[model samples]
Target: MKALVTVMPKAGVLDPQGKAIGHALSSLGFAGVADVRAGKVIELELAETDPAKAKAAAEEMARKLLANTVIESFRVEVV
Candidate 1:
């Protein structure tokens, strides 16, 4: 099974990196770019073939090690 984990900052959190990117885009003449937030994506290949089990394990991994529950949120997709 293949698992895709996307980790992103929670709403209302300050993202200095994102802000810097937004500023750079504006300087490059990009218009209407109101905001930008940086996030991470992780792709994992698992030995398990069952979709339900793979998703559950991925969620556990996200909660335990891949993401900070307080400041980050993660979504798991199985393929």
Candidate 2:
């Protein structure tokens, strides 16, 4: 089984790295960029094949180590 984990900042949190990237893009001649936010995508291969089990385990992983629940939110997709 393959799992994709996406971790993103909470709506109200400020993303400095994202802001920096936006500024860099504008400097390089990209226009009309209003805002930018950054997030992380993690791909994992799992031995489990059942979708329910994979989803449960992925959620656990996100809660335990993959994401910070206080400042970030995550979604898990199994393929």
Candidate 3:
């Protein structure tokens, strides 16, 4: 099984990198680009074969270390 975890800055958190990307896009002639939020994606290969188990494990990893609970949130998808 494979677990794909996506971690992103929570609402109200300062994302300087995201802001910078947005500015760059606007300068490059991308019109009407309002905002951009940066995030990270982690792909994990697991020994478990079941999707449910892989998803649960991925969620636990996110809660424990992948995401900073105070300022970030994570979503898990198993394939």
Candidate 4:
């Protein structure tokens, strides 16, 4: 099974990196860009074949180590 994990900062948290990216894009003349936020994607291959199992496992992984529970939120997708 394949799992995709997306981790992003929670709302209201200051994102310096994302702000920097937005500034860079504007300087590069990317047009009317209002806001930009940056996040990370993680791809994993699991031995579990069932979609439910894969999703559950990935969720655990995110809860435990993949995401910082306080500042970041994570979404798990099974493929």
65, model 1: CA deviation in Å? Answer: 0.8
lDDT of each: 0.94, 0.93, 0.93, 0.93
The ten-residue window of minimal lDDT in model 2 covers: 51-60
Residue 59, model 3, lDDT: 96
Candidate 2: which stretches are off by over 4 Å? none
How well is each residue in 1-79 modelled by candidate 1, as lDDT tens digits?
A: 9999999999998888899999999999999998999989899899999999999999999999999989998999998
User: Which parts of model 3 have CA positions greater than 4 angstroms off?
Assistant: none
Please identify model 1 stretches exceeding 4 Å from their true place. Answer: none
Q: Candidate 4 lDDT, tens digit per residue, 1-79?
A: 9999999999988888999999999899897888777889999999999999899999999999999989999999988
**Tens digit per residue, CA lDDT, model 2, 3-79:** 89899999999999999999999999999999999999888889999988998899899999999999999999998
lDDT string, candidate 3, 1-79, tens digits: 8899999999999999999999999989999988899999999999999888889999999999999989998999887
Q: State the TM-score for model 2.
A: 0.96
| Cα deviation of 6, candidate 1, in Å | 0.4
Preferred candidate (TM-score higher): 1 or 3:
3
